[model samples]
Target: MRKIAASLAVLVATTTPASAQNAVDWFGVDGLEFASPATSFRFTDLDLRDPHVFLPITIAPFPTICFDFTDNAIPTTTVSFNGNIQASYNSDSSPADGFLDASSLLWFRPLAQDGRVARVDNGGADCLAPAPTSGCAPSATAVATAYAYASFAAGTCLSSLPGTQGSPAYAPAIASPAGSCFVTAPKTFVFDNNGTPLTLIDAQIAASFNGVPATALSNGLLRGFLRESDANQIVISDPALPGGSVTLAGPAGRRQRQLFHAQRQGHAPGRERLVVLFQLQRVPGDLHRPLSAFGDHVRFTEDTR
Candidate 1:
Protein backbone atom coordinates (compact mmCIF):
# COMPACT_ATOMS: atom_id res chain seq x y z
CA MET A 1 0.00 0.00 0.00
CA ARG A 2 0.97 3.67 -0.29
CA LYS A 3 1.36 3.87 3.47
CA ILE A 4 4.03 1.18 3.55
CA ALA A 5 5.67 2.67 0.48
CA ALA A 6 5.73 6.09 2.15
CA SER A 7 7.23 4.63 5.32
CA LEU A 8 9.81 2.76 3.27
CA ALA A 9 10.58 5.94 1.34
CA VAL A 10 12.25 7.31 4.45
CA LEU A 11 15.05 4.79 3.91
CA VAL A 12 15.95 5.96 0.44
CA ALA A 13 19.72 5.66 0.44
CA THR A 14 21.44 2.29 0.16
CA THR A 15 25.11 1.92 1.08
CA THR A 16 26.64 -1.24 2.55
CA PRO A 17 24.31 -3.71 0.92
CA ALA A 18 23.49 -7.41 1.25
CA SER A 19 22.70 -8.81 -2.22
CA ALA A 20 20.27 -8.63 -5.10
CA GLN A 21 17.83 -10.94 -3.35
CA ASN A 22 17.29 -8.51 -0.42
CA ALA A 23 16.47 -4.84 -0.01
CA VAL A 24 19.02 -3.08 2.19
CA ASP A 25 17.63 -0.98 5.05
CA TRP A 26 19.78 1.60 6.81
CA PHE A 27 20.00 1.71 10.62
CA GLY A 28 22.07 3.07 13.57
CA VAL A 29 23.53 1.32 16.62
CA ASP A 30 25.46 1.73 19.92
CA GLY A 31 27.11 -0.53 22.55
CA LEU A 32 29.86 -1.89 20.22
CA GLU A 33 32.39 -4.27 21.83
CA PHE A 34 35.80 -5.56 20.82
CA ALA A 35 36.55 -8.89 19.15
CA SER A 36 40.06 -8.87 20.56
CA PRO A 37 41.69 -7.07 23.49
CA ALA A 38 40.37 -3.78 24.83
CA THR A 39 42.23 -2.09 21.98
CA SER A 40 40.27 -3.79 19.18
CA PHE A 41 36.47 -4.08 18.90
CA ARG A 42 34.80 -6.03 16.09
CA PHE A 43 31.32 -6.96 14.86
CA THR A 44 29.40 -7.05 11.62
CA ASP A 45 27.35 -4.31 9.99
CA LEU A 46 25.40 -4.77 6.68
CA ASP A 47 25.77 -1.06 6.63
CA LEU A 48 24.59 1.69 4.31
CA ARG A 49 28.13 3.08 4.05
CA ASP A 50 31.56 1.47 3.76
CA PRO A 51 31.08 -0.39 7.04
CA HIS A 52 32.46 2.59 8.99
CA VAL A 53 31.17 5.26 11.36
CA PHE A 54 31.70 8.80 12.66
CA LEU A 55 31.32 8.41 16.40
CA PRO A 56 29.70 11.19 18.46
CA ILE A 57 32.71 12.81 20.16
CA THR A 58 34.76 15.98 20.18
CA ILE A 59 38.48 16.53 20.73
CA ALA A 60 38.85 20.32 20.99
CA PRO A 61 35.76 20.65 18.72
CA PHE A 62 37.45 18.42 16.12
CA PRO A 63 35.04 15.50 16.39
CA THR A 64 35.29 13.30 13.22
CA ILE A 65 38.13 11.01 12.18
CA CYS A 66 39.25 10.91 8.52
CA PHE A 67 41.43 7.83 8.13
CA ASP A 68 41.16 6.31 4.63
CA PHE A 69 40.49 2.59 4.82
CA THR A 70 40.99 1.88 1.12
CA ASP A 71 44.49 3.38 1.11
CA ASN A 72 45.10 1.94 4.56
CA ALA A 73 45.91 5.40 5.82
CA ILE A 74 46.14 5.77 9.59
CA PRO A 75 45.85 8.77 11.90
CA THR A 76 48.42 9.15 14.62
CA THR A 77 45.64 8.93 17.19
CA THR A 78 44.32 5.60 15.74
CA VAL A 79 45.83 2.14 15.98
CA SER A 80 46.51 -0.55 13.37
CA PHE A 81 43.47 -2.23 11.76
CA ASN A 82 42.81 -5.70 13.10
CA GLY A 83 39.02 -5.79 12.92
CA ASN A 84 36.37 -7.52 10.76
CA ILE A 85 32.82 -7.08 9.34
CA GLN A 86 30.99 -9.98 7.72
CA ALA A 87 27.29 -10.15 6.83
CA SER A 88 25.43 -13.27 7.95
CA TYR A 89 21.90 -13.19 6.50
CA ASN A 90 19.19 -15.74 7.19
CA SER A 91 16.69 -16.90 4.57
CA ASP A 92 13.86 -16.31 7.03
CA SER A 93 15.15 -12.90 8.23
CA SER A 94 16.68 -9.90 6.45
CA PRO A 95 19.13 -7.25 7.59
CA ALA A 96 16.27 -4.85 8.36
CA ASP A 97 14.83 -7.39 10.79
CA GLY A 98 18.16 -7.69 12.62
CA PHE A 99 18.47 -3.90 12.62
CA LEU A 100 15.08 -3.34 14.29
CA ASP A 101 14.90 -6.52 16.32
CA ALA A 102 15.97 -5.93 19.94
CA SER A 103 17.55 -9.37 20.17
CA SER A 104 19.03 -9.53 16.66
CA LEU A 105 22.68 -8.43 16.64
CA LEU A 106 24.75 -6.82 13.84
CA TRP A 107 28.10 -5.38 14.78
CA PHE A 108 31.37 -3.74 13.61
CA ARG A 109 35.11 -3.40 14.23
CA PRO A 110 35.60 0.21 15.23
CA LEU A 111 38.29 2.08 13.33
CA ALA A 112 38.84 4.61 16.06
CA GLN A 113 41.09 5.08 19.08
CA ASP A 114 41.55 2.05 21.35
CA GLY A 115 39.42 -0.04 18.97
CA ARG A 116 36.14 1.71 19.87
CA VAL A 117 33.71 4.12 18.23
CA ALA A 118 33.20 7.49 19.91
CA ARG A 119 30.59 7.92 22.61
CA VAL A 120 26.92 8.66 21.89
CA ASP A 121 25.88 12.31 21.68
CA ASN A 122 22.21 12.21 22.66
CA GLY A 123 22.26 15.94 23.47
CA GLY A 124 23.84 16.70 20.02
CA ALA A 125 26.36 19.33 21.24
CA ASP A 126 29.48 17.62 19.88
CA CYS A 127 31.18 19.35 16.95
CA LEU A 128 33.39 17.54 14.42
CA ALA A 129 36.94 18.54 13.65
CA PRO A 130 38.01 19.61 10.17
CA ALA A 131 38.93 16.88 7.70
CA PRO A 132 42.46 15.54 8.02
CA THR A 133 45.04 15.74 5.21
CA SER A 134 44.44 12.07 4.50
CA GLY A 135 40.64 12.30 3.82
CA CYS A 136 37.40 14.27 3.91
CA ALA A 137 34.42 14.39 6.30
CA PRO A 138 31.90 11.53 6.04
CA SER A 139 28.98 12.98 4.08
CA ALA A 140 25.55 11.88 2.81
CA THR A 141 26.26 11.44 -0.88
CA ALA A 142 29.79 10.12 -0.29
CA VAL A 143 28.41 7.37 1.95
CA ALA A 144 27.62 5.56 -1.28
CA THR A 145 31.33 5.32 -2.11
CA ALA A 146 33.79 6.13 0.71
CA TYR A 147 31.98 4.69 3.78
CA ALA A 148 30.72 5.74 7.26
CA TYR A 149 26.91 5.63 7.38
CA ALA A 150 24.08 6.56 9.80
CA SER A 151 20.37 6.39 8.92
CA PHE A 152 17.75 9.16 9.42
CA ALA A 153 14.26 9.36 7.89
CA ALA A 154 11.26 11.69 7.58
CA GLY A 155 7.92 9.89 7.81
CA THR A 156 4.83 9.25 9.98
CA CYS A 157 3.12 5.99 10.92
CA LEU A 158 -0.65 5.57 11.33
CA SER A 159 -1.42 6.78 14.88
CA SER A 160 -3.17 3.69 16.22
CA LEU A 161 -1.93 0.92 13.94
CA PRO A 162 -0.18 -2.14 15.34
CA GLY A 163 2.41 -1.83 12.57
CA THR A 164 4.24 1.28 11.26
CA GLN A 165 4.48 3.23 14.51
CA GLY A 166 7.42 5.50 15.31
CA SER A 167 9.45 5.09 12.14
CA PRO A 168 11.66 7.20 9.93
CA ALA A 169 13.17 7.93 13.32
CA TYR A 170 16.05 10.26 14.15
CA ALA A 171 17.95 7.36 15.57
CA PRO A 172 19.89 8.77 18.54
CA ALA A 173 23.02 10.88 17.79
CA ILE A 174 24.28 8.77 14.95
CA ALA A 175 23.88 11.96 12.97
CA SER A 176 25.82 13.64 10.15
CA PRO A 177 26.83 17.28 9.92
CA ALA A 178 27.27 19.80 7.13
CA GLY A 179 31.02 20.27 7.30
CA SER A 180 31.85 21.05 10.94
CA CYS A 181 28.29 22.13 11.59
CA PHE A 182 26.03 19.43 12.93
CA VAL A 183 23.34 18.23 10.49
CA THR A 184 20.89 21.16 10.89
CA ALA A 185 18.20 20.56 8.32
CA PRO A 186 14.89 20.73 10.20
CA LYS A 187 12.32 19.92 7.52
CA THR A 188 14.12 16.77 6.41
CA PHE A 189 11.89 14.79 8.83
CA VAL A 190 8.10 14.78 9.38
CA PHE A 191 6.33 12.36 11.76
CA ASP A 192 2.67 12.00 12.73
CA ASN A 193 -0.41 9.74 13.00
CA ASN A 194 -2.26 10.81 9.84
CA GLY A 195 -2.87 14.23 11.45
CA THR A 196 -2.28 17.90 10.75
CA PRO A 197 0.88 20.00 11.11
CA LEU A 198 1.63 23.09 13.23
CA THR A 199 4.05 25.90 12.54
CA LEU A 200 6.82 27.65 14.58
CA ILE A 201 9.09 29.68 12.40
CA ASP A 202 12.34 31.43 13.35
CA ALA A 203 13.02 29.55 16.60
CA GLN A 204 16.34 30.68 18.07
CA ILE A 205 19.04 29.09 20.19
CA ALA A 206 22.56 29.74 21.40
CA ALA A 207 25.97 28.80 19.84
CA SER A 208 25.05 25.15 19.18
CA PHE A 209 22.28 22.52 19.09
CA ASN A 210 22.35 22.27 22.89
CA GLY A 211 22.98 25.98 23.05
CA VAL A 212 20.93 28.33 25.20
CA PRO A 213 17.30 27.22 25.27
CA ALA A 214 14.91 28.78 22.74
CA THR A 215 12.84 31.45 24.46
CA ALA A 216 10.08 33.64 23.05
CA LEU A 217 12.43 36.64 23.09
CA SER A 218 16.10 35.65 22.47
CA ASN A 219 18.73 32.90 22.09
CA GLY A 220 21.83 32.02 20.01
CA LEU A 221 21.52 29.81 16.93
CA LEU A 222 18.43 30.17 14.74
CA ARG A 223 16.34 27.31 13.28
CA GLY A 224 13.29 26.62 11.04
CA PHE A 225 10.75 24.13 12.39
CA LEU A 226 8.55 22.37 9.86
CA ARG A 227 6.44 20.46 12.41
CA GLU A 228 6.44 19.10 15.96
CA SER A 229 4.75 15.88 17.13
CA ASP A 230 4.17 13.83 20.25
CA ALA A 231 6.16 10.64 20.83
CA ASN A 232 4.70 7.13 20.44
CA GLN A 233 5.66 3.67 19.10
CA ILE A 234 4.37 0.20 18.18
CA VAL A 235 5.62 -3.15 16.97
CA ILE A 236 6.17 -2.72 13.19
CA SER A 237 5.84 -5.75 10.95
CA ASP A 238 6.69 -5.60 7.23
CA PRO A 239 4.97 -7.83 4.70
CA ALA A 240 7.99 -7.67 2.40
CA LEU A 241 10.12 -9.16 5.14
CA PRO A 242 7.80 -11.93 6.30
CA GLY A 243 8.44 -13.52 9.69
CA GLY A 244 10.44 -10.37 10.64
CA SER A 245 9.51 -7.54 13.03
CA VAL A 246 10.82 -4.02 13.70
CA THR A 247 10.24 -0.86 15.77
CA LEU A 248 13.15 1.44 14.75
CA ALA A 249 14.17 2.01 18.38
CA GLY A 250 17.18 4.33 18.39
CA PRO A 251 20.46 3.79 20.22
CA ALA A 252 20.63 4.00 24.05
CA GLY A 253 22.10 0.63 24.99
CA ARG A 254 19.43 -1.38 26.82
CA ARG A 255 17.26 1.70 27.28
CA GLN A 256 15.52 1.85 23.87
CA ARG A 257 13.50 4.96 22.93
CA GLN A 258 10.17 3.39 22.08
CA LEU A 259 7.96 5.07 19.41
CA PHE A 260 4.67 3.41 20.33
CA HIS A 261 1.27 4.57 19.07
CA ALA A 262 -1.75 4.31 21.33
CA GLN A 263 -5.10 2.97 20.09
CA ARG A 264 -7.41 5.99 19.70
CA GLN A 265 -11.00 6.13 18.48
CA GLY A 266 -10.54 8.68 15.70
CA HIS A 267 -8.15 11.65 15.73
CA ALA A 268 -5.60 12.73 18.33
CA PRO A 269 -6.25 15.78 20.50
CA GLY A 270 -5.42 19.30 19.24
CA ARG A 271 -2.24 19.63 21.29
CA GLU A 272 -0.83 16.37 19.89
CA ARG A 273 1.93 17.04 17.36
CA LEU A 274 3.15 16.06 13.90
CA VAL A 275 6.86 16.67 14.36
CA VAL A 276 10.00 17.24 12.31
CA LEU A 277 13.73 17.65 12.92
CA PHE A 278 15.13 20.19 15.47
CA GLN A 279 17.96 22.02 13.75
CA LEU A 280 20.36 24.94 14.50
CA GLN A 281 22.15 27.34 12.16
CA ARG A 282 22.86 31.03 11.41
CA VAL A 283 20.86 33.17 9.04
CA PRO A 284 22.17 35.79 6.61
CA GLY A 285 19.51 38.54 6.77
CA ASP A 286 17.27 39.69 9.56
CA LEU A 287 13.57 39.55 8.81
CA HIS A 288 10.50 41.39 10.18
CA ARG A 289 9.36 38.42 12.27
CA PRO A 290 7.58 38.80 15.61
CA LEU A 291 10.47 37.28 17.56
CA SER A 292 12.98 39.86 16.30
CA ALA A 293 14.96 39.70 19.51
CA PHE A 294 17.30 36.98 18.15
CA GLY A 295 16.28 35.92 14.68
CA ASP A 296 19.59 36.66 12.94
CA HIS A 297 21.57 34.58 15.41
CA VAL A 298 20.36 30.93 15.42
CA ARG A 299 16.57 30.67 15.48
CA PHE A 300 14.01 28.47 13.76
CA THR A 301 11.63 28.70 10.78
CA GLU A 302 8.76 26.40 9.73
CA ASP A 303 6.44 25.97 6.70
CA THR A 304 3.89 23.31 5.73
CA ARG A 305 3.04 21.87 2.33
Candidate 2:
Protein backbone atom coordinates (compact mmCIF):
# COMPACT_ATOMS: atom_id res chain seq x y z
CA MET A 1 0.00 0.00 0.00
CA ARG A 2 2.87 2.39 0.75
CA LYS A 3 4.53 1.71 -2.63
CA ILE A 4 1.22 2.33 -4.45
CA ALA A 5 0.70 5.67 -2.65
CA ALA A 6 4.23 6.83 -3.57
CA SER A 7 3.64 6.03 -7.28
CA LEU A 8 0.39 8.04 -7.28
CA ALA A 9 2.09 11.07 -5.72
CA VAL A 10 4.89 10.98 -8.33
CA LEU A 11 2.37 10.88 -11.18
CA VAL A 12 0.46 13.89 -9.83
CA ALA A 13 3.67 15.98 -9.48
CA THR A 14 4.78 15.15 -13.00
CA THR A 15 1.35 16.02 -14.47
CA THR A 16 1.17 19.52 -12.92
CA PRO A 17 1.17 22.29 -15.57
CA ALA A 18 4.03 24.78 -15.80
CA SER A 19 1.70 27.77 -16.30
CA ALA A 20 -0.14 27.07 -13.05
CA GLN A 21 3.15 27.16 -11.15
CA ASN A 22 4.17 30.52 -12.62
CA ALA A 23 0.80 32.25 -12.82
CA VAL A 24 0.74 35.89 -11.67
CA ASP A 25 -2.36 37.94 -10.78
CA TRP A 26 -1.89 41.68 -10.83
CA PHE A 27 -4.10 44.26 -9.07
CA GLY A 28 -5.88 47.06 -11.00
CA VAL A 29 -5.14 49.31 -13.96
CA ASP A 30 -2.40 51.90 -13.50
CA GLY A 31 -2.65 55.49 -14.72
CA LEU A 32 -1.22 59.05 -14.54
CA GLU A 33 -2.39 62.71 -14.35
CA PHE A 34 -0.40 65.79 -15.49
CA ALA A 35 -0.93 69.47 -16.40
CA SER A 36 0.95 72.80 -16.45
CA PRO A 37 0.63 76.48 -17.37
CA ALA A 38 1.92 78.16 -20.57
CA THR A 39 5.38 79.77 -20.46
CA SER A 40 7.92 80.82 -23.16
CA PHE A 41 10.83 82.94 -24.55
CA ARG A 42 11.87 84.64 -27.81
CA PHE A 43 14.89 84.74 -30.14
CA THR A 44 15.73 87.29 -32.85
CA ASP A 45 17.59 86.95 -36.19
CA LEU A 46 17.37 83.15 -36.23
CA ASP A 47 17.43 83.10 -40.06
CA LEU A 48 19.62 86.17 -40.09
CA ARG A 49 16.91 88.03 -42.05
CA ASP A 50 17.86 91.30 -40.32
CA PRO A 51 20.19 92.50 -37.59
CA HIS A 52 17.45 92.75 -34.90
CA VAL A 53 14.58 90.72 -36.30
CA PHE A 54 12.76 88.94 -33.44
CA LEU A 55 10.24 86.10 -33.15
CA PRO A 56 8.14 85.23 -30.09
CA ILE A 57 7.63 81.57 -29.14
CA THR A 58 5.93 79.67 -26.33
CA ILE A 59 7.12 76.61 -24.35
CA ALA A 60 5.18 73.36 -24.64
CA PRO A 61 4.39 71.81 -21.24
CA PHE A 62 2.10 68.86 -20.81
CA PRO A 63 -1.32 70.41 -20.24
CA THR A 64 -2.86 66.94 -19.99
CA ILE A 65 -0.87 63.73 -19.69
CA CYS A 66 -1.85 60.15 -18.88
CA PHE A 67 -0.77 56.51 -19.38
CA ASP A 68 -2.95 53.43 -19.88
CA PHE A 69 -2.18 49.93 -18.56
CA THR A 70 -5.27 48.27 -19.98
CA ASP A 71 -3.41 45.69 -22.03
CA ASN A 72 -0.62 44.95 -19.56
CA ALA A 73 -0.52 43.29 -16.18
CA ILE A 74 1.25 44.52 -13.06
CA PRO A 75 4.22 42.21 -12.79
CA THR A 76 5.41 40.50 -9.63
CA THR A 77 9.08 40.96 -10.61
CA THR A 78 11.09 43.74 -12.18
CA VAL A 79 10.10 44.32 -15.80
CA SER A 80 11.17 46.72 -18.54
CA PHE A 81 9.44 47.90 -21.74
CA ASN A 82 5.83 49.10 -21.93
CA GLY A 83 5.81 49.17 -18.14
CA ASN A 84 7.91 48.24 -15.08
CA ILE A 85 7.29 46.85 -11.58
CA GLN A 86 9.51 46.29 -8.56
CA ALA A 87 9.10 45.16 -4.96
CA SER A 88 11.52 44.65 -2.10
CA TYR A 89 11.77 44.27 1.69
CA ASN A 90 14.37 45.68 4.03
CA SER A 91 14.83 42.71 6.37
CA ASP A 92 18.25 43.51 7.78
CA SER A 93 16.95 46.32 10.01
CA SER A 94 14.29 46.40 12.73
CA PRO A 95 10.78 47.50 11.77
CA ALA A 96 11.26 45.96 8.35
CA ASP A 97 10.16 48.16 5.44
CA GLY A 98 8.40 47.17 2.21
CA PHE A 99 8.10 48.90 -1.18
CA LEU A 100 5.91 48.82 -4.29
CA ASP A 101 7.22 50.43 -7.47
CA ALA A 102 5.92 51.61 -10.87
CA SER A 103 7.13 53.86 -13.69
CA SER A 104 5.80 55.34 -16.98
CA LEU A 105 7.04 57.22 -20.03
CA LEU A 106 6.68 61.02 -20.45
CA TRP A 107 6.97 62.96 -23.70
CA PHE A 108 6.56 66.59 -24.84
CA ARG A 109 5.67 67.72 -28.32
CA PRO A 110 5.79 71.13 -30.03
CA LEU A 111 2.70 73.09 -29.05
CA ALA A 112 2.14 74.07 -32.63
CA GLN A 113 4.39 73.23 -35.58
CA ASP A 114 3.03 76.04 -37.73
CA GLY A 115 3.02 78.46 -34.81
CA ARG A 116 6.56 77.56 -33.64
CA VAL A 117 7.88 80.65 -35.38
CA ALA A 118 5.86 83.75 -34.48
CA ARG A 119 7.00 85.49 -37.62
CA VAL A 120 9.74 85.25 -40.26
CA ASP A 121 11.02 87.47 -43.08
CA ASN A 122 13.56 87.00 -45.82
CA GLY A 123 15.16 90.50 -45.40
CA GLY A 124 12.96 91.91 -48.25
CA ALA A 125 13.84 88.81 -50.34
CA ASP A 126 11.99 85.51 -50.70
CA CYS A 127 13.27 83.03 -48.10
CA LEU A 128 13.17 80.28 -50.76
CA ALA A 129 15.33 82.39 -53.15
CA PRO A 130 18.54 80.69 -54.23
CA ALA A 131 21.14 83.10 -52.77
CA PRO A 132 20.02 86.77 -52.65
CA THR A 133 18.59 87.17 -49.15
CA SER A 134 19.80 90.24 -47.21
CA GLY A 135 19.76 88.96 -43.55
CA CYS A 136 19.15 85.79 -41.51
CA ALA A 137 15.63 84.31 -41.33
CA PRO A 138 15.53 82.10 -38.21
CA SER A 139 12.98 79.43 -37.29
CA ALA A 140 12.73 77.40 -34.11
CA THR A 141 10.77 74.58 -32.40
CA ALA A 142 11.00 72.65 -29.09
CA VAL A 143 10.81 68.97 -27.93
CA ALA A 144 11.36 67.00 -24.73
CA THR A 145 11.11 63.59 -22.99
CA ALA A 146 10.49 62.69 -19.34
CA TYR A 147 9.22 59.97 -16.98
CA ALA A 148 7.21 59.70 -13.71
CA TYR A 149 8.21 57.60 -10.69
CA ALA A 150 6.04 56.48 -7.76
CA SER A 151 6.63 54.18 -4.80
CA PHE A 152 4.22 52.85 -2.17
CA ALA A 153 4.45 50.64 0.90
CA ALA A 154 3.73 47.09 -0.20
CA GLY A 155 2.74 45.64 3.16
CA THR A 156 0.68 48.59 4.34
CA CYS A 157 -1.03 50.26 1.37
CA LEU A 158 -0.90 47.51 -1.23
CA SER A 159 -1.34 44.41 0.89
CA SER A 160 -4.10 41.87 0.48
CA LEU A 161 -6.68 42.23 3.23
CA PRO A 162 -10.34 41.22 3.37
CA GLY A 163 -13.17 43.35 4.82
CA THR A 164 -10.76 46.24 5.22
CA GLN A 165 -12.18 48.74 2.69
CA GLY A 166 -15.37 49.29 4.64
CA SER A 167 -13.63 49.47 8.02
CA PRO A 168 -11.81 52.51 9.39
CA ALA A 169 -8.39 51.15 8.55
CA TYR A 170 -5.32 53.28 7.84
CA ALA A 171 -2.08 52.28 6.18
CA PRO A 172 1.36 53.85 6.32
CA ALA A 173 1.63 56.84 3.99
CA ILE A 174 4.33 57.18 1.33
CA ALA A 175 5.96 60.29 -0.12
CA SER A 176 8.35 60.97 -2.96
CA PRO A 177 11.99 60.79 -1.94
CA ALA A 178 14.32 63.78 -2.34
CA GLY A 179 15.56 62.74 -5.81
CA SER A 180 14.17 63.59 -9.22
CA CYS A 181 12.37 60.75 -10.92
CA PHE A 182 11.95 62.92 -14.02
CA VAL A 183 14.82 65.09 -15.17
CA THR A 184 15.75 66.90 -18.42
CA ALA A 185 19.13 68.16 -17.26
CA PRO A 186 22.52 68.59 -18.99
CA LYS A 187 20.08 69.38 -21.81
CA THR A 188 18.96 66.96 -24.52
CA PHE A 189 20.23 67.98 -27.97
CA VAL A 190 17.36 67.95 -30.40
CA PHE A 191 17.81 68.48 -34.18
CA ASP A 192 21.45 67.42 -34.11
CA ASN A 193 23.37 66.04 -37.09
CA ASN A 194 22.16 62.63 -35.98
CA GLY A 195 19.35 61.25 -38.14
CA THR A 196 15.82 61.86 -36.78
CA PRO A 197 16.87 63.65 -33.59
CA LEU A 198 14.21 65.06 -31.23
CA THR A 199 13.80 68.72 -30.17
CA LEU A 200 14.70 69.58 -26.56
CA ILE A 201 12.67 71.35 -23.85
CA ASP A 202 14.19 71.99 -20.42
CA ALA A 203 11.88 71.99 -17.41
CA GLN A 204 12.43 71.66 -13.67
CA ILE A 205 9.66 69.67 -12.02
CA ALA A 206 8.89 68.94 -8.31
CA ALA A 207 6.12 66.59 -7.17
CA SER A 208 4.83 65.03 -3.94
CA PHE A 209 1.83 63.29 -2.38
CA ASN A 210 0.44 64.28 1.02
CA GLY A 211 -2.15 62.89 3.45
CA VAL A 212 -2.29 59.62 1.60
CA PRO A 213 -4.43 56.90 3.19
CA ALA A 214 -2.75 53.64 4.05
CA THR A 215 -5.66 51.47 3.01
CA ALA A 216 -8.43 51.57 0.42
CA LEU A 217 -11.49 53.60 1.39
CA SER A 218 -14.76 54.48 -0.25
CA ASN A 219 -14.08 58.17 0.34
CA GLY A 220 -10.29 58.08 0.57
CA LEU A 221 -8.59 61.35 -0.28
CA LEU A 222 -5.05 62.59 -0.91
CA ARG A 223 -3.40 65.89 -1.84
CA GLY A 224 -0.84 66.18 -4.60
CA PHE A 225 1.55 69.07 -5.25
CA LEU A 226 3.18 69.69 -8.65
CA ARG A 227 5.48 72.57 -9.42
CA GLU A 228 7.38 73.61 -12.55
CA SER A 229 10.52 75.60 -11.87
CA ASP A 230 11.06 79.02 -13.47
CA ALA A 231 14.42 77.98 -14.88
CA ASN A 232 13.04 76.37 -18.06
CA GLN A 233 15.00 76.33 -21.32
CA ILE A 234 14.45 75.24 -24.91
CA VAL A 235 17.11 74.16 -27.44
CA ILE A 236 16.57 74.03 -31.20
CA SER A 237 19.00 73.08 -34.00
CA ASP A 238 19.42 75.57 -36.84
CA PRO A 239 18.80 73.59 -39.99
CA ALA A 240 19.75 76.64 -42.12
CA LEU A 241 23.14 76.86 -40.40
CA PRO A 242 24.60 73.42 -39.84
CA GLY A 243 26.23 72.91 -36.39
CA GLY A 244 24.61 76.11 -35.14
CA SER A 245 21.96 76.06 -32.37
CA VAL A 246 19.61 78.41 -30.50
CA THR A 247 18.75 78.35 -26.81
CA LEU A 248 15.81 80.07 -25.09
CA ALA A 249 16.11 80.63 -21.34
CA GLY A 250 13.70 82.48 -19.09
CA PRO A 251 13.34 83.75 -15.49
CA ALA A 252 11.49 81.96 -12.69
CA GLY A 253 7.74 81.77 -13.09
CA ARG A 254 5.04 80.03 -11.04
CA ARG A 255 2.49 77.31 -11.94
CA GLN A 256 1.69 75.67 -8.64
CA ARG A 257 -1.36 73.39 -8.55
CA GLN A 258 -3.19 70.83 -6.40
CA LEU A 259 -4.59 67.47 -7.59
CA PHE A 260 -7.14 65.35 -5.79
CA HIS A 261 -7.63 61.56 -5.94
CA ALA A 262 -10.81 59.94 -4.62
CA GLN A 263 -10.94 56.25 -3.91
CA ARG A 264 -13.77 54.25 -5.51
CA GLN A 265 -16.14 52.06 -3.56
CA GLY A 266 -17.09 48.41 -4.13
CA HIS A 267 -13.66 47.42 -5.44
CA ALA A 268 -13.01 43.87 -6.56
CA PRO A 269 -10.47 41.67 -4.88
CA GLY A 270 -6.95 42.99 -5.56
CA ARG A 271 -8.27 45.90 -7.62
CA GLU A 272 -8.97 49.57 -6.91
CA ARG A 273 -10.23 52.63 -8.80
CA LEU A 274 -9.32 56.27 -8.32
CA VAL A 275 -10.63 59.48 -9.85
CA VAL A 276 -8.24 62.43 -10.12
CA LEU A 277 -9.21 66.08 -10.46
CA PHE A 278 -6.57 68.39 -11.96
CA GLN A 279 -6.66 72.14 -11.50
CA LEU A 280 -4.33 75.15 -11.35
CA GLN A 281 -3.68 76.52 -7.88
CA ARG A 282 -1.39 79.51 -8.44
CA VAL A 283 0.26 81.57 -11.21
CA PRO A 284 2.75 84.07 -9.78
CA GLY A 285 5.78 85.19 -11.79
CA ASP A 286 7.16 87.81 -14.14
CA LEU A 287 5.32 88.17 -17.45
CA HIS A 288 7.60 89.27 -20.25
CA ARG A 289 7.17 89.21 -24.04
CA PRO A 290 8.11 85.53 -24.20
CA LEU A 291 6.17 84.33 -21.15
CA SER A 292 2.38 84.10 -21.34
CA ALA A 293 -0.35 83.39 -18.76
CA PHE A 294 -1.39 79.88 -17.70
CA GLY A 295 -3.65 77.85 -19.93
CA ASP A 296 -6.66 75.57 -19.20
CA HIS A 297 -6.83 72.85 -16.50
CA VAL A 298 -7.42 69.10 -16.94
CA ARG A 299 -8.79 66.06 -15.03
CA PHE A 300 -8.90 62.27 -15.40
CA THR A 301 -9.34 58.89 -13.71
CA GLU A 302 -7.11 55.86 -12.94
CA ASP A 303 -7.82 52.24 -12.19
CA THR A 304 -5.94 49.27 -10.80
CA ARG A 305 -7.35 46.10 -12.37
Number of the top lDDT candidate: 1
Tens digit per residue, CA lDDT, model 2, 1-305: 11111111100000112222211122231212233322211111011000011112233663432211212322232221111111111011111212111111111111111211111100010011111111111111211122222322211111112221222322222121121111111111122212322222221121212223111111111111111221123232333322343332311011110111122244333222111111111111132111111112211111111
Off by over 4 Å in 2: 1-32, 38-140, 151-305
| Cand. 1 TM to true fold | 0.18
How well does candidate 2 score on lDDT at residue 77? 21
TM-score of candidate 2 against the unseen true structure: 0.15
Cα-based lDDT for every prediction? 0.19, 0.17
The alpha-carbon deviation from the true structure for residue 54 of candidate 2, after best TM-score superposition, in angstroms, is 39
| Candidate 1 lDDT tens digits, 1-305 | 11211121111111111121111122342222222111111111211121122111225767444332211323332221111111121111233321211011111122121212222111101112121111111111110101122211211101111221133432321222111111111223231212322232322111112222211111112222221132223222334222333232312101222112231123334212221212222111121111112234422212231
Please give each candidate's TM-score: 0.18, 0.15
Candidate 2 backbone overlaps, count: 16
Error of 1 at 120 (Å): 30
- Candidate 2, run of 10 with poorest lDDT: 6-15
RMSD of each: 23.3, 28.4
